[model samples]
Target: MHLNRFDDLAADVSRGLARRTSRRSFTSKVGVWLFGAVAAPLLLPVARGRAEDRYAGEEGDPRSCDYWRYCATNGYLCECCGGSANECPPGTTMSALSWIGTCRNPADGKNYLISYNDCCGTAQCNRCSCSRHESETPVYRAGTANDIHWCSANESTAINCTVAVVLGAAEDEV
Candidate 1:
């Protein structure tokens, strides 16, 4: 009645376009999701800790998370194992599994290590450092209840520690 012949052609073209796009972009969709897995954390401008778990001072003993001490350059902290770079963060030079790239202090040529918290470990669930929306700071798990929260204590300039090394020590980096 009203040029129905072209209607079917238009419908066919629409389906064809959809099918082509789906097939061609299948991997890209998957890759984007995969890339987001790690990109979320690395892209953080400044990995800020939660207010509930904020370090007041060296209260519990040797303050574990030293902000001023490590003073990460590339948004990374330094976690050492028995004062050895080998036992430090995964990418640190001192770590035996020094698979990570090397980065030295701009002021001191001495090699430093980028620290890493056990975001995924046995004690706690794998905290996805990714997010769909941007927030003011990074979120961490820190409650004495069943769900425990902890981060990698790196070498920092802080004279005192708010927390102590309870996990992932030199002998325990297995």
Candidate 2:
């Protein structure tokens, strides 16, 4: 008996369809609802808290630019103005546009994802000189590049300064 590739494929597809049809009958609407009711309680605690809290850090001084949170930071310090380490200055709007930087957190010694958002409608705060480049790239590749001015979308003119805000820690790949 000689069997071709197409014959083997057809037999495999037929077996798959038979198994799917059999399995489909077992998963009814009532079964799905019952599964959710039983699983929701077990999963609630894992999903209840804010995901951002997992990357919270208590290290680094806001006044200094070379603080631990500013490991991969590239911009003017918000602390120089009225803003703290993770906030925009008063009267200045934090631009939704930002660059992602993988900064090393000294507290936990892990790389955290930091969003360097530009504070619009304000002059540049030239106090701190924190320019830690970890995975920074050139202006042509603006997605991961922190050197480029990221305030063009919010403000009409050039970017005044930038603020390093912790978005979250980098999760390990499974």
Candidate 3:
């Protein structure tokens, strides 16, 4: 009988402590609660994602930043396919290209095709960058056979998606 009474008392005490602990979890504890509040923003996103996203394409230009490597909405530097974009071999272009209806010239009415140099990484410095443009005169024309190009964001193409039905997004103006 005495042993049963002791057991009952022990169980009651255990239940009370459990209830108190649960209730206390949400309370405003001084150092711990305030520290957690301060650290929440930094921890929330990290808790949501796994570790692979941070180093997806590290093999190619380890510094390059992309969707998988950096946090969403945060901007970071990224690498592209080659040396300076415009200076790419013969067929490559140094600009990112979007479809335009028969590319038109902003300086004059004459239409010509072009694309955006979304990337550049070579002697030419034609990488898609914060500002993309080329001066009429080459900055470093060392020899007569020099090949170079500049990354241009304003460039566009005349390829119409509805008509040709090929790859690439619809014409984007800008």
Worst 10 residues of 1 by lDDT: 126-135
User: Which model is ahead, 2 or 3, in terms of lDDT?
Assistant: 2
TM accuracy, model 2: 0.61
- In candidate 1, how many Å is residue 101 off? 2.5
TM per prediction: 0.17, 0.61, 0.16
- Report the Cα lDDT for residue 75, model 1: 18
lDDT of 2 by residue, 1-174 (tens): 245743453344334323222223233222323334544454334323312332345553555543556656666677777787778887888888778878777667777787888888867666564565668888787877876666777744444566788777789521
lDDT of 3 by residue, 5-123 (tens): 54453344334323222212222122123334444454335423422332222211212221111111011122332322112333333344322122233223333332322232223
Which segments of model 3 are wrong by more than 4 Å? 1-37, 40-49, 53-154, 157-174
RMSD of 3: 23.8
Put the candidates in TM-score order, highest first: 2, 1, 3
List the candidate 2 regions with Cα displacement exceeding 4 Å: 1-56
Residues forming the 10-long window of minimal summed lDDT in candidate 3: 158-167
Clashes of 2: 0
Q: What is the lDDT of residue 119 in candidate 2?
A: 82
lDDT of 2: 0.60
Give, for candidate 2, the lowest lDDT window spanning 10 residues: 20-29
